[model samples]
Target: MPYEPLPDLATLSLAEIAALNDARKLPPVAQWNPQTSGDSLMTIRADGRWFHDGGEIRRPAMIRAFAGLLRREGDGRYWLVTPVEKQSIKVEDAAFIATDVAAQDGALAFKLNTDEIIVAGPDHPLVARGTAELPAIYLAVRNGCEARINRSTWLQLVELADADLTAASQGVRFALVPA
Candidate 1:
């Protein structure tokens, strides 16, 4: 007898296979945030997972007031992934020191020249360090001071970088920063 080929999965009707696929890849229902517009953000209740615009996932982490940056994908979508860990500090905190770059000896140093922050923690003295031009928020603990990076600010930075880099490098910048 001749071997038989399997049926094409794509050929199946939507109603016929929707239930089976949903069961296998079923994510928990999410609690929608009224503050966010459009279908960009989703909060899954099953595991407290947060899905951002560009399929970026965030867990239960304390996001800070002024850390990270946001970038837009070509498909009219935005991604919020921070280079540093998801903790941020207010710009006006007493412990916060704005400097050019972060150093091990410096508890909290902000690189005004580069627009970055360097922070230290108890367990790890050089806990977090990153530039202020990314699309995510961060939090750092240093000198008994807790710092937070704002998500909104991060998003704005991402948008700005995208435009400037695009024009200057003529698409070379896109290679440097991933979508």
Candidate 2:
């Protein structure tokens, strides 16, 4: 599906902001406690794309909705949980892609493929994962979920970091670290 950027939240009405946030919020999957009945017929690709059965899930909004419903159990397993049922889903790597970034006053914020936004702060730490030679950078999403930072975004982040250097950031090397 063709993509359109989300409208600026600052310009939106209070009701509009509430509506957008409500749509992004998923049901309490963690508290549902549904029996693990079956595996989800879905796989998240290494490049942060999702597929079901076989074909790609091309709708960003649909993908965003599903992402909100995803959960990770204590045993390092993934599931899509609703009030009625819980089902497993395969993740080749991370489940999300950090597609866009914005920087303000030395702080970095990200926009996901699903249109959700997060700042790379305490709750949303940015780190590089994967091998040293070819790292997969990530920004934390809600819970324990981490979104893979794409190459272009990573480059932009580097540029921002360089441009907004501070004494604390001086010599604070940002390198590929395990996620």
lDDT measured at residue 136 in model 2 versus the true structure, 0 to 100:
73
- Across 39-120, the per-residue lDDT of candidate 1 in tens digits comes to 3242222222233343534322222212122222234333233333222211222222222222222132222211223322
Location of the lowest summed lDDT over 10 successive residues in candidate 1: 167-176
Give the lDDT of residue 177 in candidate 2.
Answer: 37
Q: In model 2, what are the clashing residue pairs, if there are any?
A: none
| Number of clashing residue pairs, candidate 2 | 0
RMSD of 2: 5.1
lDDT of 2: 0.70
Tell me the spans in candidate 1 whose CA falls farther than 4 Å from its real position.
1-116, 119-136, 151-153, 156-179
| RMSD, one per candidate, in order | 21.0, 5.1
Choose the strongest candidate by lDDT. 2
Tens-place lDDT per residue, model 2, 1-179, is: 45556775334544453466565546776687886569889998878788999999998777877898888777777888888888888988787888877653444556677787666666566676677567677777764677888889777666665443211121233443343
